[model samples]
Target: MSIALAAISILHLLDLVILITSTAANAWIVDGDLSADLWYKCTSKNGGYHCKQSINEDWLQAVQALMVLAVLFCLLSFVFFLCQLFTLVKGGRFYFTAVFQILASLFVMSGAIIFTVMNYAAASSSYGYAYVLAWLAFPLTLGSGLIYIILRKTE
Candidate 1:
């Protein structure tokens, strides 16, 4: 039980880290010296990088909001999990944590999907590691949620 608890905690922490990285990284799309993210568009020039605020597109804004929400929900879920771990009755499942985590996963999926569909028409660049990390976080968060649902508090 202790091992499972520790593993679940680790998974949740990992998901949170991935979510933060994907949201903040300036490499959602990359082509040669050009890279773009939710917040900025950057290009390598001479020996330095030039960056500017991202264009205000509805879809891009939606993606940005969704990603931020995903991070918030994941953080909230972790807090709830810790609180529940100590106060929840034996055999009580981590339903609140699971629900928040599942919502976080959905937000990540929505953001990634929106970015993929909308960005397809905007640029011919390849998706970068940050984009891949967003997709990766979706499944990990979902799996973590499912695990939480199945996990019961035990002495």
Candidate 2:
């Protein structure tokens, strides 16, 4: 259980890094200059769609901040799980940890979905494979939450 949760934590951190990089192109305080833009363009091509974007710097930053908070919440939930693993009985309040995780995952997913939809609405643009990883994250997170529920009440 610990190993599984640890792996999940690591994956969550990695996803956060990717999410941050994806936003780098339009950071208000860290403008995605020409070189950075080119990098995004190149990497994006590998992902099955044009990854390059022209987002409003402030909007991009705002989105990043929101997602970061979501990730932090996930981390917090994991921390709670860790505490319970060490101190609680097998089934004591596991549901609470799972509930927090589920809520956090839902928030992150909604944010990502909203961001994608808004991006399309703003520019009528399409996203490609780079988004696959993000899309993949949603289910993984949800799965984790479900795992907690399954494990709950187990002797």
Candidate 3:
């Protein structure tokens, strides 16, 4: 049980880190010298990089909001998990933590799907590591959430 608890904690932390990195990274899509992220679009030219704010598109804005919300929920879930670990009764389950984590996964999945669908026409460019990270976070969060649901406060 101790080993399982530690593993879950590690997974939750990893998910949070990946969420933060994916949200902050400026490489959701890359094409030659150009790269774009939720916040900005950057281009490399003449041995320098020029960055500009991302376009004011409704979908992009939605993605940004969802990603931020996901990170926040993940953080909240982790905190709640720690609190419940100590305060919860021996037989009680981590329902609150599980719900928050599941919500976070949903948010991540929604944001990534929106980005993929909106950018489908831009086949010339390739999806970057940040984009992949966003996708990767979805399943990990969901799995952790399910695990939390099954976990009980055991002595």
TM-score per prediction, in order, is 0.97, 0.58, 0.97
| Model 2 clash tally, residue pairs | 0
Q: What overall lDDT goes with each candidate model? A: 0.95, 0.54, 0.96
Q: After superposing candidate 1, which stretches have Cα over 4 Å from the reference? A: 121-124
Q: Give me the runs in candidate 2 sitting further than 4 Å from their true place.
A: 1-62, 121-130, 153-155
**Residue 4 of model 2: what lDDT?**
62
User: Can you write out model 2's per-residue Cα lDDT over 16-130, one digit (the tens) per residue?
Assistant: 5554443343321221222222123323233353345445565445555656665666677677767776777756656766776677667657666666655533233344433
User: Residue 33's C-alpha lDDT in candidate 1?
Assistant: 91
Ranking by TM-score: 3, 1, 2
Global Cα lDDT for candidate 1: 0.95
- Residue pairs clashing in model 3 are none
**Candidate no. 2 TM-score:** 0.58
The digit string of per-residue lDDT tens for model 1 on 20-121 reads 999999989998898999999999999999999999999999999999999999999999999999999989999999999999999999999999988853
